[model samples]
Target: MAKPITKIDEPILTEKEKQDQSLKEVLQDLSQNADGIKETMQLLQELHESGILGAINNLVEAKEQVAKIAVGQMLRPPVTNAINNAMAAGGLLTEMNPETTKKLMGGLSKGLQKAEEGLQANKKVSVFDLVKLMRDPDVNRVIKFSIDLLKGLGEGLKD
Candidate 1:
């Protein structure tokens, strides 16, 4: 029988060997993810071809200037007014009942259609015709709504 083993020897890797092993593992990983790498390269190539990549790079480099310009533009009177008007409109919309708004919009659509028909007819309205219109329930309802709206506007203006 051979002599009983007293020591177990393990191989020790040199620094160069360790580096080579790491490189090999990296190459193996690259091979495994070849499809993903190819797709990424293709997308990069498309962005580069479109000049978007350069634009993005310039934008990144001049971020401060771009930001200042944006802020300046937003501060202009017309832009500020637009933003304020939109905010006010949004606030008003939030305060209004959706059902009432829907009804008003529907009424407006019908009113516009009728107005168009009236325009096409090109008929002159006499004082008597105006008086006759008061007898119309639709006309009376609109008149009442207009009066109420005016009253509310006047009340708001008082503040």
Candidate 2:
């Protein structure tokens, strides 16, 4: 015999049932988000042609700045001594010839300062931002310039 229809199949939800439905939706969303992150990791690993270059460029700039500091420290002791003395002079300004010394210090200090700012700024770039820049004309131009620079060096070697 055909089974009788039952109230158990009625279309009504208890409070707990409603909460369970909401929780399931939230879990599904979280699962999707997690999947998205895994995809991004896979993409990053496979494609080194994106903002990775930009990050390297930033890192190279930072290294150049550090190199400046290292190089500047080796300057004529007289100049180094002057900068040190200027700092010791201490006045309305934190130190004397701040601008001059800063200039002398070069990109290393500037890069370090920028890094400090970036760290403190806590700014985050989204994956969308990365993709956008990777497709940007200006970004492509810079990438091309970098490639041309390497090609020039290679040609110089062959010549």
Candidate 3:
């Protein structure tokens, strides 16, 4: 025996009916967001009035050419060198101890302050004055620190 036709087994819509339903849904969505669409249009109009929108449109149209030129520039020796140097510096910073770096920066600040004060005093330093200054604990400490720093730098360069 053949199965009987029922409403649940029927086709939902014909092709034309489906297209009309889709169009109605799209129109409803547009109507619901009409205010947002208007705001977006106004923003785009302002950008166009300022000439930026036109420039952006031109850029987009020539994107392939622009991208090729940008890639060529980046591949040039100087640009590549800068990129490499930045990476090396970044790697060096990462390897360094943060606390030591902070301490060194703080010491440099203090040293700068002292140097400024000395400059303001306008005092001439004789050989004897230099010897006397070396006797000062802070000066002696900094001299030792500088010597050690130079030694370490030399060792690193030897590699």
Model number with the top lDDT: 1
Each candidate: what lDDT?
A: 0.97, 0.79, 0.96
Better structure of 1 and 2 per TM-score: 1
lDDT at residue 129 of model 2 (Cα atoms): 87
Ranking the candidates on TM-score from highest down gives 3, 1, 2
> What does each candidate score in C-alpha RMSD?
5.3, 29.1, 2.7
Q: Give a tens-digit lDDT track for model 3, residues 34-118.
A: 9999999999999999999999999999999999999999999999999999999999999999999999999999989999999
Put down candidate 1 lDDT per residue, 28-87, tens digits, no spaces: 999999999999999999999999999999999999999999999999999999999999
Compared with the true structure, model 1 gives a TM-score of 0.78
Sort by lDDT, best first: what order?
1, 3, 2
| Global Cα lDDT for candidate 2 | 0.79
- Clash tally for model 1: 0
Better of 1 and 3 by TM-score: 3
In candidate 2, how many Å is residue 43 off?
76
Q: Give the top-scoring candidate (TM-score).
A: 3
